[model samples]
Target: MADFDVKPSVIDRVRDRPRRLQRLAVLIVILGMGLALLYPLLRDRHGAPIEVRDVPRLPPENLAVIPLAASPTDDPRRVALGRRLFFDARLSPLGRSCGNCHVPASYGTLRAARSPGLGDQLDEFNVPTVLNAALSPYLGWKGKITSLADQLHRVINNPRHMGSNWAWVIETLSADSDYRSRFSALYADGITRSSITDAILAFERSLVTPGAPFDRYLRGEFGALTSEQIAGYELFKDYGCIACHQGRNLGGNLIIRFGILEDPFKDGFFDAATPKSKRFLKLRVPSLRNVAKTGPYLHDGSVETLEEVVRLMARYQLGREMPEEDVRRIVAFLHSLTAPLPENFR
Candidate 1:
């Protein structure tokens, strides 16, 4: 065998090699620790355990119903035009329409604690009811929107909601011959973004809950509701929920943070798995009208059943425990809030 010897390369003797490896190892450890700290911050906030007894049974008078807005019947043509635009799916760039989230006949599908967005991803907050929405002084869970017209424009342009800008919306609506003719007939400005918003608002303003058993009861028909439902109504009032929820709409007058009296955030009730922000705990108290049809209760859609919602309110809001039977009765009363859909919307 020939004698062959090899010498080490100059690069192998560099002083920075050990130091670089050590830095890389330290970086890896720090990154791992950071992620470990963030795991709980990214978790869901809806699965907190609730104590049922905390909520008080408010008086029936305190649980005022939400009142419906006046219809635009004075201008039948504009209202008719608006209704057509509202149902048109062409309003969205992605081909999804408002009705996709706010189902007209279904207690407003958007009324759920958190409606699914374009591709089934959950929305950040619960969808408020369109029923009597026009009567509300403010809109959204945070009461960010001030007027129906303004809210219409915001939703139409919001990337998460309608996913289109004003120009695109106007252009899309103008392209439809029916919309063009209606716009020309209704407004002097023809098919513009403002007109589109006005039309949609007109239609939304007309979404009123028809006479329900509860409404009939309110009208002095004592037999409109069953004994069990009446018992639930009593329980609803006996609870102190009336303090914040009282109004023609049963809610919407004031803003309150969830878990205020009791620590709702302690058990991860408000964004339990997500990073803590003051916004997560603040929400508009929703109207109880037609609540039976709207399921997956609460802002995060954590409570699957109305019974669970009642129990949670008792524990978290009322600061007391309620029997399962009482919760069931309360749910029964809630069912009486359902009313028939408007003829035009159907």
Candidate 2:
């Protein structure tokens, strides 16, 4: 070996490297300990835990046992006025009424996925039935509006729905001698935007669906539902549909993002152009009381037939592909939920 190479062995250099690494390791451990000690202090400096579940469900007295609604207000005249306004096409500048989209015969959902608004584009979401709206803890798919009155105001202003400004709505209704007189009589403070909302809300509250076959079954009417319907009800509960869709209206107690079990929106079930938050992927659970009539099911109106809806829910909500026979039976059961329209609604 060369003399220079023999002067310092490779092992000597390796030993020096180990010492350097040990010093660096010690420094890193010290730094870690300091961060661990300061972590609690940093965490405590920020926000406290928030209590979120304080809001209560609508009181029992306010809801119908089957197709739930708020208990009728003491003012009958206001409700009567509301009913007239509900059917009046004059509420819109385009001569369209609420019934134009929310066909009472169709369980409140619009025939098309979206109804034409003021613009060329269709409305974003399906026109949910006005039936049982009062039973919901919050309004709209996102639960944005809290009260029926607030919802009415937003819809009137929404160009796609009512397409009228506050001033125009007030002026339009005020000009109607009949509407102005009605508003004056119902509201203590006289006609105003607030009074208009009150009248509309009063009518909405009156749109209740009662005496359905399902209601009869709940009331111990053994023959109200056929054997297939009974089987479907069993499947509805057994498959965990009752977990989210329960209570009087059969839904609307809580806001759950859609596609909890599977991503239904991924397969083009909803409009991709809409914001992610506003898509059919997120929604409040809808009432299934009149599910049969509410055709073109789902928020995007992707599934038209009740059988398809049942299968989709089974696959998406339950995470299991349901058999066709099972789906058909469930559809039969859903049909029982369709109560004869209230005489007043007719």
lDDT of 2 by residue, 1-346 (tens): 6978966887687677857788998999999999999989877664233222222444653233344333566378887877777777877787777777777777666788766766688765777888878767677866667889778888777878887667876777778888777777778876687777777787777777777888778778889999998998888878887877777878877677777788776777556566666544556788887888777777656678988778778878789899887888788988888877755566
Report the CA-based lDDT of candidate 2 relative to the real structure. 0.75
Q: Candidate 1 — what's its lDDT? A: 0.73
Q: What lDDT tens digits, residue by residue, belong to model 1 across residues 1-346?
A: 2333222444456554778787898999999999899867654332232322223353333346543433545366766777777767788886767777778766676646686665667778666667777766768877777798888878877777888777877888777887778789889999887777777777777777758788788778899999999998888888876677677677766677776556766776566667666534677777777788777677767777888778778887789889988888888988988878776677
Residue 35 of model 2 has an lDDT of: 91
Candidate 1 lDDT score at position 299: 71
RMSD of each: 20.0, 9.3
Top TM-score hit:
2
Per-model clash counts, in order, read: 29, 1
